[model samples]
Target: MFQETPQDALVGTWTNSLGTVWAIKADGTFQVSLSKNHRVDVWGKYTVTGDEMTIQESHGSHTPKSCRGKAIYKFMRDGEMLTFTKVSDKCKLREKNILAGWKPWKG
Candidate 1:
């Protein structure tokens, strides 16, 4: 069971300089926006293990064509800096540390 609900913690707006954003809903519906003003609202069931946050965009209109392009943003940390990444079948590689989404409120 979740000890602390991100419901109160992660329930807010988060953005990256590249224009990607992660807006987490209290109920787990997540919305992500990209650099080109493109966005997808996903049914995101998430899990936080240590510094890693993994969210699967279960139900969204995101196309497979772009799934490997920019479907999701997975965040992790390395040593000190935070990293944002996306998993694309095209690359078959988890792009490492794109950019840590910005949250001024948390700072």
Candidate 2:
């Protein structure tokens, strides 16, 4: 039997009901695409602490300059699906969209 590690469970692409995509790799690096064209790419680093995940944006093209700092979210997992609930206001725009809910990328 193969055991799934906490880190392993989070290493994949996730998308919202609206088609926005967010990818979290095993290396702690992440990418988020807010648009269908994939032009708005946000690059950042993430860390997992218990049930909370914190994302720190170091650089990005389309992300808000003011919301470029650290973002905190409460996460829960259901099988292969992961949901992130934004708890930090640092990334207001991100919080607004993601605060609702997101699902793991199946494809």
Candidate 3:
């Protein structure tokens, strides 16, 4: 068996529970928008290992001014499509949304 790389987790663009699209950049920066021309954050940090990935939300017009959110996801790749399930953790609201399959990822 071969060892897996952390970079693998950051390879695909993903959508949020609310149907927001977020692109995962090759340089570990992420861009997400809540609507057309209404980008929440132009850039943010990303950390990933194996099937798990976390995107750190940045300050922007689309995001809450006082909100500091991190989206943790488990990725599953099927051909050109990537399905990211939110990792619920201990947050009931977070868990519920993630498990509901509100997010999707693709090339």
The prediction achieving the highest lDDT against the true structure is 2
How good is model 1 by TM-score? 0.47
Cα-based lDDT at residue 50, candidate 2: 76
After superposition, the stretches of candidate 1 with alpha carbons farther than 4 Å from their true spots are: 1-8, 35-43, 58-98, 104-107
Against the true structure, candidate 2 reaches a TM-score of: 0.81
Model 1 weakest 10-residue run by lDDT: 88-97
Q: For candidate 2, lDDT tens digit of each residue in 29-78? A: 98888888765478889888878888866467777777778888888878
Query: Model 3 scores what on Cα lDDT?
Result: 0.59
Q: What is candidate 2's CA lDDT for residue 90?
A: 71
The better candidate by lDDT, 1 or 3, is 3
lDDT scores for all predictions? Answer: 0.47, 0.76, 0.59
Best by TM-score: 2
**Candidate 3 deviant stretches above 4 angstroms:** 1-19, 38-42, 65-67, 89-107
Each candidate's TM vs. the true structure?
0.47, 0.81, 0.58
A best-first ranking of the candidates according to their TM-score comes to 2, 3, 1
Model 1, residue 46: C-alpha shift (Å): 1.6
